[model samples]
Target: MSSDTSKFGEYGGQYVPEALMPAIEELDDAYRRYVLENEDGFVDEFRERLRDFGGRPTPLQRADRLSERYDTDLFLKREDLLHGGAHKLNNALGQVLLAKYMGKERIVAETGAGQHGTATAMAAAHLDVPCEIYMGERDINRQRPNVFRMRLNGAAVNPVTTGRGTLKEAISETMRDWATTVETTHYVIGSVVGPHPFPTMVREFQSVISEEARRQFDDQVGGLPDSVVACAGGGSNTMGAFSRFVSDESVDLYAVEAGGSSLAVDEEEGVAPNSASLSTGTEGVLHGARTKLLQDRDGQIVESHSVSSGLDYAGVGPELAYLVDEGRVTPVTVDDDAALEGFHRLSQTEGIIPALETAHAVAWLEQATSEQLGDSVVVCVSGRGDKDLESVIEETASREIPNAPDMDVFSGGMR
Candidate 1:
């Protein structure tokens, strides 16, 4: 751990309201003891559960077709193959288990893309704990499959209708609930954002991505890749893919952000056409942490757009913001069109359907120069696309994506 513990350079700290202080303090202590010190074999049990339940040691497979197409050695960290079809299970299971250890009776979480909510629902069910999820109403409509999955796992799904009906509003609602019910409920933050202990604790759990990748890369390919790429929203997967590789000066990390329709913002309307916070955001305090955010000149958070619901966040993880500022992680953007193309490209060529969020990272391959990518590269495929089929069909039909297949065949429905 760093000397400061609660912060990543100048970015992370507990900036919550007074009502949430006790919960934060308790969580901070629990994180230090169970997570950091591994009290009562907590770490051992967590690993065993991950192996037996959540499916750890996800594959690091070489992408032969992608490599041949790009004339480079390309690899994929297959987090999409995890039990819940996303890297979200890594942190979700860990946090839920921690809550059990802390004697919490219920779990509450906020989700945008719904992967995190599904993972939390699964974990809560597996652990025999009650769970409730707060999600933006718009996202619920966009990701109905995931909503059904959460309900099937015996979790209640609450719709947050405030503030554009998206992640920011959902988080605010969850936090409000937590503030009132902190004694019996634990909040499972979906990503590497939020106040103290959450950013650090979530990273420690999610770091298993890079931990396995770094070892697998050395054993299979004999050295670090020249570059590692992963999509960044709230940046759990981005930090997961880059955490273990950060100390290696020779390895370059790229954080692909959703560029939406454009990078320009309508300050008067308080809307940013892109979710490229790490690329175009200025420093601001949001969601209890200091980080780069898509904000208007008056310091109000602006609405962000993304074809992928998962990447529609207005701010990024503080650690990722610090890393970008330190020049350890490069921030890049992929427009919705390129991301759609990459989604189809991977499905057609590699026989893999990536989540639209992961497609942002895939799109970067096409946008980056060969020299920029280097000869050896690794891309983290964060989630599967099953939950995105409806959105993809709709969005692809509206855009002139040259690689998109005919969607008319699905007129009878995806069944």
Candidate 2:
């Protein structure tokens, strides 16, 4: 909410077609009116909805067993318990509220694992607005339960088959849809990506995570955690977790990425690496905002791979790109097998089934140490994994096969 900034230190800007400018302007104006200008209690109304309808003030719980195993103090910000089953609902509710203020009759959104799509659909249904969700055909199959949930919430799910048929393509398709229907439609971008106002807007909506966590951590732990961690795709969850802590230099921030198949690759055909974007990608634009993106030497975007459908993207949020350049956030990568192990570990040890996306943060513990992690660490368990049961079963079956590459990476976060 800094009046002095829109571009995140040269990482975020409006790099879209000229035709989209008016819609962006209108959106910015409406957001300022409804959210920033709050004499009418617009923000309080939103807070009421979040607490009573969407379930805010999600608990911060100590992970005694997991902490014992890791030999470090571990805490979980249980965003998994929120209604709609993920941190996606926070942004979805706020954006839908903005759409209502803008007099938009319909909502358009994109999803990778279907969590955001389902969350948006539920928000639209609650507010009695028509909703359309663009998701990849591949993601719909892997995340079928969420697809059904979206349908049940009265939202239309459009499958995008172009490109890698994942998050990036879904965003492309959503952008195309929003372009033509700008009059009646509002694009509820699910993550901290997209053009100027969006990356900042989503962060504000999701900032409730850190705002509540900071006080709760002080109350529970009697001090700030030494480190805060979350999985990063478009980086909403990570941004939320790190929002307040970023200014506290003594607290370390870690953003774990999806190391789909390999942590590093050089022109290997059919091999995709989703992690190492800020670490390896060049400055580029994707989904309207200029940031770090995986691309070839010719500047064409390359394919990104991930076992977790949610973290399967070729780019990250502009704010995260800024944080990377400033060295405020340490970027790390966790591969499929390691993340799967994290999923199992939490389920067995803590009785929590995390979404595959959140598992990537948990997977970082395999290679971590008490010295580096320090006495207290908080990891955002961003979502529950009920939607990923079938996928996890198949991944476990693949691991049972001898000579499977997964076994080697099981001990490490990288492929």
User: Which candidate leads the pack in lDDT?
Assistant: 1
Q: What is the C-alpha lDDT of each candidate?
A: 0.95, 0.87
Q: Tens digit of lDDT per residue, candidate 2, span 281-370?
A: 789988889999888776777888888988888889999999999999998888788888888888878989999999999989876767
What is the C-alpha lDDT profile of model 1 across 50-128, one tens digit per residue? Answer: 9999888899999999999988999999999999999999999999999998999999999999999999999999999
User: Model 1: runs farther than 4 Å from truth?
Assistant: 1-4, 410-415
Superposition error at 170 for model 1 (Å): 0.4
User: Against the hidden reference, what TM-scores do the models get?
Assistant: 0.98, 0.94
- Stretches of candidate 2 above 4 Å error? 1-4, 266-271, 400-415
Winner by TM-score: 1
* Reference-based lDDT, residue 137, model 1: 98
State model 1's lDDT: 0.95
